[model samples]
Target: MSSNNTSQIAAASALGRLSPVANAPSLESIVAAATQLVPLLREQGQQTEINRRLSEEMSRRFEEAGFYRLMQPARYGGYEYGFTAMMDLISEIGRGCASSAWAAALGVIHNWLLALFPEQAQDDVWGPTPNALMCGSYAPVTMAEPTEGGWLIQGKWKFASNVDNSQWAVLGVQFPPAEKGAPPGAGFVVVPRREWTIEDDWFVAGQAGTGSKTVVIGKPSFVPAHRRLLFPEAASGKAPGTAVNTNPVYTIPFLAAMPVCLASPLLGAAQGAIDVFVDMCGSRVTRGGAGGGGNRLSGFSHVQSRLAGAAAAVDAARLVLDRDTSEVEHTVSAGNAISVDKRIRNRRGHAYSAKLCHGAIQDLFTTVGASGLTLDQPIQRIWRDGNMIAQHITLNWDAVSTMAGQQMLGLEPKGAY
Candidate 1:
């Protein structure tokens, strides 16, 4: 066996023989760590928004906690935990700062994708330098030309969250021109920082701190074939990395499981808005009316109704996310392929839940009166972030609903469903 193969075997064996460390971190402990960061993150939300990215200090804290390794392969010294653990952690962080949660989620989630590449590719990415942060944009707008040893790719990938903090990126690239009657080809190209440049263009109102700027592939960079992960293979829940990383968690359909990352943060943001609004309503006395100075806003019937509606919607969104994700987990554990219909349903389920979250935040924001309009208020930030998240193409309810409808009608769904 080659050195890399020997390393994989040794690492796997170590993981198998490993005993629980004293005070070893559990998912609950990780969630608590995230919760502990909330107050500090909330306090820094405005500053982070102005900076247009998460602080290096915050990123270091996350790395120190090993929070980003939740979905990484055990051979790479990762926890290889389930998606639900990650969801809970991200949601807890989102309750403090949506942008922080978003930046963190996008930055770390790519580790799971990286685990799908060939062993050599995985070694190239994480072997010598196992602690590198990764980010990606999966829009196949790049131009790829066939080359001797690899493909020469050139283009810009937009909305790459936390690109400023990453040392490597997974960029979407098209397969070389297909022959007549052949299906159009698409896949991911993993490239180190030396191959690409980060463009500063992430300025926006909502989730501004994500720093989801454009990634410019400076000149034509050559990515070897080993670094490529075809979308179809990933959709089928099989990939090169599966040969070494045998965990079922790593085999879940990429698209179906990824929506949780995009939607869960928004769910938590909406919940945060509700939390802030509820706390505000309790102490602030009503001004200018028969009930002025006598009635708290929480006492008003309309306020009560709006809070109830918002809370229920947020709860329902969380439930939908957990339910669908749990089902995907169970299916993977059973060694079964997730049906196309199920993937479509998962897509729509995420979009629907995000829509509900948007509406809940809207209701909550609308009921908060002028106080919510101020940029300083946490509710306003949550509202803005939730709105931005709802606008994500993955969470576009109308499009997802159409895809689901087409699948239901016995027609092929289109466009990354």
Candidate 2:
């Protein structure tokens, strides 16, 4: 049998032994399912990059593993495990393939994002197909025209990740000002697949497997009022969907903890780099160096130090992610609003963790010598993916640090938290 079929059969056997409910697997069992896919993911990493998108079998595998439902409402056949659980699961997937993990991370987190929309929007998505997934573009680059019952949107939304697998899209657009002379407000409008077309425009040097193409609305599409969610409302603990979903997980601010999904995959990619580095070190020998031709790479002090530093950095990043995410979950569950200070701190944690992970991968990549430059080397791919992730607007170290520092110094923070 093919590896894909064999993997499916094995996953089925494991599920039969572990989870009684296929839709709502226990955290341990679900994580175990992700763990089992790691080898397959690693095996497919090259092909995934080559295709510039995740395979149908891979998407199906993730769905069967129940990874996408980690943060969805239980009423919608999800586990509602919250952000930390998502971080843990995505990080494990990252250890195998960062691009796949990136796509999967967004797939899972968008479920939580959808839960923050109005009840009608939620039902529109999951009421008919509970397993349906969504892709999103978060920059409000165009303004929506006020229509009779809702709004008419026409434009292209870039970087809609995992667009190939998604049945719906949450597009960012500016709504007309509530009052004359007021500035237009930014928010999201949920549109079904029929309303938009996917543009094949995601060619990039890193994270190519995410399939983050452009979503184009060639003609004006009418989105009902109930399908819209304003940014401010999402940033607040109480969103329109909160009344019905009522999960503390949905109450957490959008930018406060959502960036963790972006950082979690980098954390896993850094660890994966370390794993490949160590394995390479164990067998590699110097060919032509001042020291000697046959000396073992691992016996060198520089190699050992790089490994230690990289491991420490990865550990520190994981700690920051866990602490901040856990704190958010605890505060929201206790009925407390996520304070501004906490939000900025969490933002700092997200950026700093990405910095740490990128640094770790960079340190490891430098030690790999000329062989690491080859396309087949996983370390090179990890390094590129890490760099790409760190450069994301949400995780960019300089921007995030400046925002946090401004908040700390009693100046109004300038950017999204």
Candidate 3:
């Protein structure tokens, strides 16, 4: 065996001494738990961005609060909550710190993603540490070499959110065809931290605390066959891991509502901006105009309209998110396959919801004028983070809107659904 293989084996053996599994917490209690941390999250928000990573203390708090277990498999000590519940919890966190919430949201959703892998892959991750978190880069940018038992993979994966806090990584790789007539295939392979190294390249103006750096395997690493999960298997709503996991939550098609994980944080960040703007309106005074320096900014009808519009936008976005998420969960619970139409509709909802949230933040930011631009102010950060999130390909308005329009018009949707 190679040194890499030996290291993996020894690490796996050490981690195989599993910790005692705790019972899952109720959704209400977990949401309350997350709410209780908002004050602290805000307190640390600046430092989190300065460090370009979530504080270790905050990560520990999230772990203790069972935030990571919200959508995890019950057999592995997770709460097994659905997407709607996840939205509630993550949005609450985002209200305090968008970047931290982004990291936490990914941590929460990846538990659900990992459950879609094969049984041994799940076991390889959770058997040793049931509460272990995973970070992922889902673009298949590299190919893997076929070898004994599995494949040898080596590449750098970017935008691995919350990578600093994760014990494992789910990397997207393209597998070469097994035969001359076969075509190439794409899939994910789970690897332990021992097999890869982190690159400190996550500096950004928005969501900086997420630590979404690059994960590199400078040398080829062997991944066992059972650790792989193909894209089609995941999108089919009947993944291999579903056989053992058996939860309808796991059976929901990938891309149907997975983008909600990206949207929820923006929902909260927009709300947070509104919160700050509302407070500022009450105390801020107008200056250098006919209104003079003593005039209350909140007295202006235009300011009132901005607040109302922002509030309405947030409310509308939430309704769309709640409706689509409920429909997905209900359909899966009834053992019905999530239809392509519904999937595309959900995709539209995700992208549109993000747009609404981004617009709300932009409206509130305009009302705040110069005060909202300060680095110390949370509104500026929220505004910046919301803009960054809106730029994500999955949530981009132009791309998703066109794709949704095509699907609605009885044409083939040309984008990932």
Candidate 4:
């Protein structure tokens, strides 16, 4: 139900195989397009905030750039660019608008999860439309029981991101418990959009544009066994997706790459925050400390220090995110298991990056002053978005240090975050 890692399933057969995804085409083009479209997105961002959702134009631009297919497997007409490509693009999108990037990222990643469905389950959704979208809240459980050919799922799942735009959903359910100490049965059920209704439940703080609503599945619906994938199986190395998706990337653990996916956007948002703050420093006036400082705010020594600190934070964050992304691509291509120690290291690196974003935006926003609170001010939005991002499970600093400590001591972290 959480985010995931990139490909890495080693065996005698995988030793000789390379990454199935194309490599020559760097992510530069997509990132460039996202950067170029920022001003355009800003024009609509204000409206999206007012409307409490991402603007249609913003969605279309991302879709046209194939953002929606970033994670879906290749056999289903998806780019399957792996975590690197997705991280790069998401970072770029984040530069323009955090909420927009978060929504798109969720939609795309969830699609990849859907691609892991058993062939029969995959067919029901993608067979009708390869690009069919599925979203979920991933919080509550949807109960299911064995039936003739499948399990009947019944329960409500809340916080289904982008539900209004999806045609189907993947609901995590706790199946009937098995023997006491034996593994508990769990699965993700695929259900049609019409079979469930959306409730306007996302009325909280930041990332408001994500439209994270509640999914109401009143009664049990027959979910062909093929349409259900065991959650515990996925937690382990084995997954039904392997039968249909032969690529090693599909076999990669979901929680592993999740850090990369989420961290990249935070880095981007931080970079964007730095850019705005530096630009603001050049024109703004300081308080009564120095009367009529020459050439505006640029003359102050403290101003220089703040700029340096904020800029350094942004740079550090980008490096950590980029390094983790490369680590994913390289390790996956080589077909190696990312040891728990390595995962812990990555968690620490990524959490530090999140800290950079959180600190930089807050630090820089302070200098911008009272004017920065306006709705039109980019700083205000960046502050809100960055704070929201810091709360993501992947970036929780406490959890990162705890897991890292466990790893160093050779104890199972249990993926606590």
Task: Pick the lDDT winner.
Answer: 2
Q: What are the Cα lDDT values of the candidates?
A: 0.84, 0.89, 0.88, 0.71
What is candidate 1's lDDT per residue for 10-114, written digit by digit as tens?
443233122123334677778888989988988899889999998899999888877787777767768776766677888889999999999888865788889
Candidates ranked by TM-score, best first? 2, 3, 1, 4
Better of 2 and 4 by TM-score: 2
Q: Which ten residues in a row have the lowest lDDT in candidate 4?
A: 9-18
Reference-based TM-score of each model = 0.92, 0.94, 0.93, 0.87
Model 4: per-residue Cα lDDT over 121-222, one tens digit each: 777888788878777655437557778987777777877767777889888887776666764576678888878888777775676777777888788777
User: Residue 332 deviation, candidate 4, in Å?
Assistant: 2.6
Instruction: List runs of model 4 lying over 4 Å from the truth.
Output: 1-26, 180-183, 286-295, 414-417
- Record all residue pairs in model 1 with backbone atoms less than 3 Å apart, i.e. clashing: none
Q: List the residue pairs that clash in candidate 4.
A: 3-254, 4-254, 4-255, 4-256, 4-257, 4-258, 5-254, 5-256, 5-257
Q: Residue-wise lDDT of candidate 2 within 1-417, one digit each (tens)?
A: 899976754443232123223556677888789889887888788889989888889999999888997888888888788787888899999999999999999999999999999999999999999999899999998999998999999999999989999999999999989999999999998999999999998889999999999999999999999999999999998999999988777899998899999999999999999989998989888897685899888998998999999999999999888878877876776788989899999999999999999999999999989878988888899999899999999999999999999998999999897
Measured with C-alpha atoms, the lDDT of residue 10 in candidate 2 is 48
Cα miss at 62, model 2 (Å)? 0.3
With a 3 Å backbone cut-off (N, CA, C), the pairs that clash in candidate 2 are none
Candidates 1 and 2 compared: the better one by lDDT is 2
Could you report the Cα RMSD, in angstroms, for every candidate shown?
7.3, 7.7, 10.2, 5.5
Write down the TM-score for model 1.
Answer: 0.92
TM-score attained by model 3: 0.93
